[model samples]
Target: MTTSTAACAFERKDWLDDYAALKTALEQRYANLAWFASPQGGVDLPALDKRTRRLLETAEDESMAKAALSAFVSGFHDGHFSTAGAVLQPKIAQPLALPKVDYSRLNATQACAALGYGPARGAAFSLPFESLPGTVLEADGLTRAFRSGVVAAPDGTRFGVVRIARFRQQDASPAACEQAWSERQAKGAMSEADVKPVKQAANAAWLRTLAAQLQHFREQKVAAVVVDVGNNPGGNDTGDWAVRLFTAHDVHSARMMMSAAPLAALYFDEQLDGLRQAQKEQDPTPEAQAMLEQSIAAFEARKAGIAARGCDLSWAWSEQRPWQPNGCSRLIDAGYASGQSSYLPPKAFGNLKIASSIYWAAEVDDLRGAWNGPVYVLTDGGTGSSAEMFSALMQDAAGARIVGRTSAGDGCGFMADAPPVVLPHSRLRYRVPNCVRLRADGNDEVAGVKPDLPVLPTEGENDRERAWRLLDTVAADLRARGAKP
Candidate 1:
């Protein structure tokens, strides 16, 4: 009556082992674990173990194990915490058949009328659109699911409309970049030459796209521009170009902090090495050398302080606390005063304050004479990550009006590159964020960016139609106010 282990449908022992490994990895590596643990009812290690045991006991296969893991991760309610490597076969609902629109023979004005808009006295152009459920049309040698262009009111006021589907770079595709990364890894460690080209091309293309839009606005003498980012899942930080076009100086975007000293040290070392290599290739200017020297000195001081504390190399300063000389006093006082918990590091490690650094958008030289007109950005719950970051910058730095629903709160904090790990047993890949972004104002966290003019769709009105209506309304309002370009 004895059963062989290999013949069993599910192995409880194997599942338990994998679960233990995953728990350890999460505790040690997950950036948000400490912050979220207490809020989620104090971790409850033994209770978690018991729950996981029951889950494994009932899990019929690897798929069930993965489901259990996914459920466990979802309890954190963190958008960044996710499980990959699951072959999902979701049920597909039948799509509704809709009539397509034809605009091949129509001129710009006629096309605008056909697309449910009034006469277009100004130029109309095609916009690259995707994901939106609508009829697409070919215009000006471009495939456009939506039309975006300049419109001039009868009163001689002009407005520019630009619809952006995502924050992805213009020239580089995600699939191509991923493939290139894989190829580079197989060849060996990536060099500057291997990585720089794709990044440079993407940057150039993104800047070019923004520049083109700005040039068009200037040419049309538009008093304002509407940027549509509705239903954007977000992508790269290429939205910086738009920020630069409106901002005259450097703008402090966000603050970044690492959970571990090793991570920060690794980043600093990489930056230093890159700068030094550049210096070696050609003599750096006096100012550049001085900057490098200062950075080196700062890095050394931090390293010495860490060594003196006797703390593990992995220990990093908490971003929650200010980096004063006696910053650790409050932590120590709270722990000793309560006697319920201790914030102190191991005896081998001493107390040290870690400093949080600010990220800024540097002024762009090419954007010196760029558009300074009023800006309106459209957002929705689907706007997240870099899209949220862009919206924050547009609102905080460029004085752009956000006109739509509140954005997705994915960029509440910052995340650094913590690559995914594959489980040995079920081969499930877990992606963990490395660093937590802390802002002094705490505005970008959780609540997301608020819209200046929150627009909601009415009955029988779709999101697209509502957005267009809002854009026109805002333009008219600006026109009424005698806003000038």
Candidate 2:
């Protein structure tokens, strides 16, 4: 466990080196520089740097040095910002010597907290599924009936409800995959070769099971369907697949980019490589072509910014643009066409990572309109990450109505495969989300997607009543919409 770099005593020279290394890494890897530096975040990194640097300089021992470093990162007040681990060498990073620190708990930084970082607003989406009549499929287990069926509206109309609690492929996988996974986990370590196909098979099963549920809804001749993501804490790209299943047309997800760092360049290159492979297999549809163009421009911008400002994003330190009155910089949009694209580049939410072995590039092409009918989604503050993503996509892409309240404002957090960035002296490893998802409104999803048909608790309304009222409202609207040709 003790290499030369790791074993370095907290001598003044060693301490300073660690501080400098950590500073350099943050400059390069921390993605929030643009947003936090802008008027939006108002984080005066230059001033904070001066203050923290002085603290580090005065430190005669390790404890003082740690405090100085923690203060510098803490100054941003972002939960995403924190120390990672100790570095043994140039590229080698390991876990924390102390417990891994989650900066989110600090809550000092207005960067996220002020912008709805904590509990989201509005009523919970706990609908009365138990109250439905016997004619409808009684939801049994998570699998048996796929946790779906029909709900009878008070006025004698019928509607379908599909409750998707989470988006993890492993969770929703087939029974066979679950058995294989159970067996695999029993072993000390999981081998990649054996794990991936099991997941893919399960994902295919999950999708089929869901598709079948939707088909059942269609067979029942329901006026519309409500996709309930209440209390749904987001997960992987299953959101992308789920959105595709509900609507016949292509639905564009949010756009995102990382800060200009080594990983940023790598991220863009890997994406381009994926695109190249895509081109090899099939012709570039207009959406793929557009995604390519926008992506290339973003890639070049990060390169140019890095070339101009170095890793610290120094260009924004002293009012680079009139727009940056707060003394921070923001990544300029790469001129995407019409804010809508037919295809989403694979891993658009998550690009390259050091931790993974395989990457899937197949875009969800099921435009067969799985539900073709009017679709409405139910969400609450509990809905976050990919769940919030589903809410946005269903509303923006499929023309589905989002009812209840605003979603959890997670927007985008850590991307796939969080390989740590260890400091040379301290060896403290850390990571940050290298990407962001921009909603169609030109705002980041960090500002939670607003519901189209907003419903909140009237002062005395109980949780149960609130849920029923929302359903009643949806039913009334569907009845009105149904009356049309």
Candidate 3:
């Protein structure tokens, strides 16, 4: 691929004198990044050194380089910071085309299908579909099948659903978006009181509405429950609420274990894997040999520590797994248990807010047994983080069949704070990822759970239509079993 010439030319200029204050402010902003020390409670000197050199060399005018490097280092899939400083990338200037319909506001799959989609088929007890590579679906042309529930079914077995496509707005400035979000929050798009501390009562209210719909299916003796999370960009408590609606009241919380030790496990694994791949090449460097030794030493130390704690070490034996170096990545260390849980506790002790704020109890007694029939969940690339966590828990605990497209496997749970870090010479600004997100199963190291049934929508199947198809399939299954529509 051809490299960027605009970036190279800009790097040649003496931008220091021309943009001194902006450079200074940028440097100051990223300084706090140093705080992200390695497992031994010290920053990896080599890594930091390399990163600093990269920043300085590209700081002059290579905006693309900066963005690429940031993304490379952070490991976050779509972190906005990585896109910063791009000088020559084409700006988005095309005339915008708003979605013809607001699928998000539609509560049922029948309504979504009316908008122009196919029959509903869920992850379980349903047929598969296809994908559309270069198509933009218009929302205004479809039928409307909505009534009172967030999700609906056209038949006893088929499941129909509705969800958000993606959040896209023309001319959406950061300030403007924040303002709009604030206004929406004020208007109760989520809850009445503060959205933070994730209100259980308010969350329950929303969930009860969904559960009531499910109850309708139950009353009709429907075979399955069609759930559409497509439009779900994911709210804090929304996924949690879903779990409560489907599972049993006697649910047990899965143990969650998190520490900096897994970092060594991941690092050594990557190094070993890279060497194994490079072993097929011509000559391996002497530096690579030394790196191998260091990685082995670190791996041994981490293994000993983790093993003493009775954690599983089988992951250490896996060979040559490709590694993604973005900072958001994780590797699961073995450990799993089954039981009942209404709330998740802190992995360690520091996260009091998370441990206490989340309430898992709800009106539905048990999701696994509540329906007394088949259960289905719809997912796609957008299902991530807590949503992924909720899905995994359901699959593991309640045996819910996951349908639609594969979920976004970006399930790291730790929150990233943007505190400022100061650099040594430039007095520059930077931020580093702190804290680890532990899964319900206790290991803080795994990517999001993959779907059991991976079904992609057809090329012409819009998201709304996909949900409806799933619902119809589920409804048909229910009717076949002598259930009412």
Q: What's the TM-score of every candidate structure? A: 0.61, 0.63, 0.45
Best by TM-score: 2
- What tens-digit string does per-residue lDDT give for candidate 3 at 359-475? 223233333334445666766776665556566666666666776676664443333234343322233344332223344443332344555555567898765576456555555
Reference-based lDDT, each prediction: 0.50, 0.59, 0.39
Clashes of 3: 79
Candidate 1 lDDT over 1-485, as tens digits, reads 24455347566677777777777666555545444433222234344556666887788776677677777766655566677556334446885777554433333333333333322211122122222233232222123222356654344455666655555543223323334345445655544344455444435444555556666777878788777676665666455435666544444444443334344455445444543443443444574455445545654554345323222211221122223211221111000100111111211111111100101122133553367778778787877766676777778767778887887756533233555656667666777655443333532233466788877768998654664566566767786767777
- The regions of model 3 sitting more than 4 angstroms off are 1-60, 71-200, 258-372, 415-446, 457-485
Q: Report residue 219 deviation for candidate 1 (angstroms).
A: 3.9
Give the clashing pairs for model 1: 309-350, 310-348, 310-349, 311-349
Model 2 poorest 10 in a row by lDDT: 352-361
Task: State the lDDT at 167 in candidate 1.
Answer: 59
Worst 10 residues of 1 by lDDT: 331-340
RMSD from true fold, candidate 1: 14.5
